[model samples]
Target: MTGPRFTALAQSLPATVPFVGPEAQERAAHRPFAARLGANENGFGPSPKAIAAMAAAAGEAWKYGDPENHDLRAALAAEHGCRPENIIVGEGIDGLLGYLVRLTVEPGDRVVTSEGAYPTFNFHVAGYGGTLVKVPYRGDHEDPEALLAKAAEVAPKLLYIANPDNPMGSHHPGAAMAEMVARVPEGTLLILDEAYVELAPAGTAAPVDPDDPRVIRMRTFSKAHGLAGARVGYAIGAAPLIAAFDKVRNHFGMSRISQAGALAALGDKTWAAYMHRLVAASRDSLAEIARANGLTALPSATNFVAIDCGADGAFARRVLTELTAAGIFVRMPGVAPLDRCIRVSCGPEAELAAFAAALPGALARARQG
Candidate 1:
């Protein structure tokens, strides 16, 4: 039998996997991590209500989830004080990003983002053959002005910004974000990824008219909601832009059980509040741990912390490798300056204690090597 012919795009693209998960690392290490902190997942788990909802929905897995995500959109609309037409739910921010790129980017279309921002977003842009234009962070924070200038210069179709940014854990106020949005060129669409927004301090999220045509804000249930496995996320924008998602998105991509779980998670405000407190406490504990080792922890508004290793990227890389070998899975930034720090997720006492216990040995070994 003849093999199927590949599209030119598929044939031209390199075979690459974006992330090697902790389970893969464990397989290579021949042991499970004592503390899982690499991926910024909320170790606090989901609300009891959400778990119960999923359990109840499990029996109904034979049925398909609502293609339009009507009920979930309705609940979200009420919660956010926006009409349901302004929302488009997808598998997660990652999936939404792919759709957004597909909608806006033809091959060679320019997309602007910070040099070391979320790799998943970059991955999507690459998958669609979008040309990436990266601006460097201005002292640990994504430089809004620099991004805007680049957008103006390149006239890129999409501009990606993650407020309460990943890797560095720095953020800008909502007013600043609003100002940045106002300055975006008419044809350029701003993709404000707020995956960690719910975990940020007050005023960190910019306020924008839901009907604004220049921007689309994407959010997820993965971080503070502890529903990473649910693969539920939504994008908020003008009705027209939101409606455009239907043109190409997988109508029934969401699982029935995940939809039920996400709906429950949204309604459980108490659990969300509790998770916020736990995150704050964990941040403080992680800061203390870093100080004890003579490293400085960057201030974080998300469910993780990035600790400056008081050294270069090589030293940080050594520390990260040693940490993994010590059964503490953690990650680091991908580029220079920022790459001098390691990122660790916030978790419960047991997990934090394990990280703390293992740090000194890891550091010593890294130093000796």
Candidate 2:
């Protein structure tokens, strides 16, 4: 019997998972983690109103979701002061990123991104056979000037940057981002991932003309709204670019329950504020824990902190391993200099205490090794 034929790109790619989930780790270890802080998930959870909405929509789960995402889009547009045509909602930022890469990249097309930025975007680029030209991070932040220089040199189809960057939790001011936007070379589209913007300080989001074709900004309910599992994300850009998603997107991809939950979550301003306060407090606590343990917690505007381990990537890896062995789940960066620290997500006091209790032993054992 003959097998199904595979495309050249499919054959060329290696099987990989960009991030190994906490659940998979639990199964392998044959025990549940005492603290879940590795995945950057909001332990506070979705708004109560969102929970109610999802419960209300559960019976309607059999029905297919609206392909147009009309109500959600309208609500989002109202919130952003833009028309519905300027927004497109999808399964999540990851899915939207794939669609964007598919829309713009052809085989051998050039793409520019930081060396240790979001790896999933790089995964998508590889899947589509795009050639990625990566620049190193400037300190803990993505270097806007260096990225623009590379984009100008190669005229890449896509330039990717994550504000309040992940794995490091550093951010640039919105004005700086606006300046970067102005300098984007002609013929290149910028992919601005703002998944953490809701948790960041005021004025952290750049001002972009809704009709400007130079950039498309991706936002999600995953971080601040505590809807990570619900998987609802949206992109804002020029109407034409937004409309182009209709050409290749999954018409009914978003879950009906997820849509209901996200829509409700978006409207709960009080809940969002409470979460912001909770995350800020927990972040401070994490920093204090790091300080007590003789580590330096990087200043962060997001819901997580990167605690420098006072050594190289190997030592940080050992610390992480010891922490995981002690049942405190945490993660670190995958590349050097950046990887010299471990990333911990903000959570409730109980979970933070668990992390605090375990960190000292983890560090001591790592030091002994």
> Which structure among the candidates has the greatest lDDT?
2
Those runs of model 2 whose alpha carbons end farther than 4 Å from true positions after fitting are none
Instruction: Please give the distance, in angstroms, between residue 238's alpha carbon in candidate 1 and its true position after superposition.
Output: 0.7
The deviation in Å at residue 312 for candidate 2 is 0.3
Q: What lDDT is reached at residue 295 by model 2?
A: 96
- Quality of model 1 by C-alpha lDDT: 0.94
Model 1 bad stretches (over 4 Å): none
**lDDT by residue for model 1 (1-369), tens:** 988898877777778877889999999988899998999998999999999999999999999999999999999999878999999999999899999999989789999999999998998898888899999999999999999999999999999999989989999998999999999987999999888999999998779998999999998999989999999999999999999999999999999999999999999999999999999999999999999999999999999999999899999999999998889999999999999999999999999999999899989998997
lDDT of 2 by residue, 1-369 (tens): 999899999999989978999999899999999999998899999999999999999999999999999999999999999999999999899999999999999899999999889989999999999999999999999999999999999999999999979989999898888888899999999999999998999989988887889999999999999999999999999999999999999999989999999999999999999999999998999999999999999999899999999999999999999999999999999999899999999998889999999999999999999
Worst 10 residues of 2 by lDDT: 172-181
Cα RMSD of all models vs. native, in order, equals 0.9, 0.7
Error of 2 at 91 (Å): 0.9
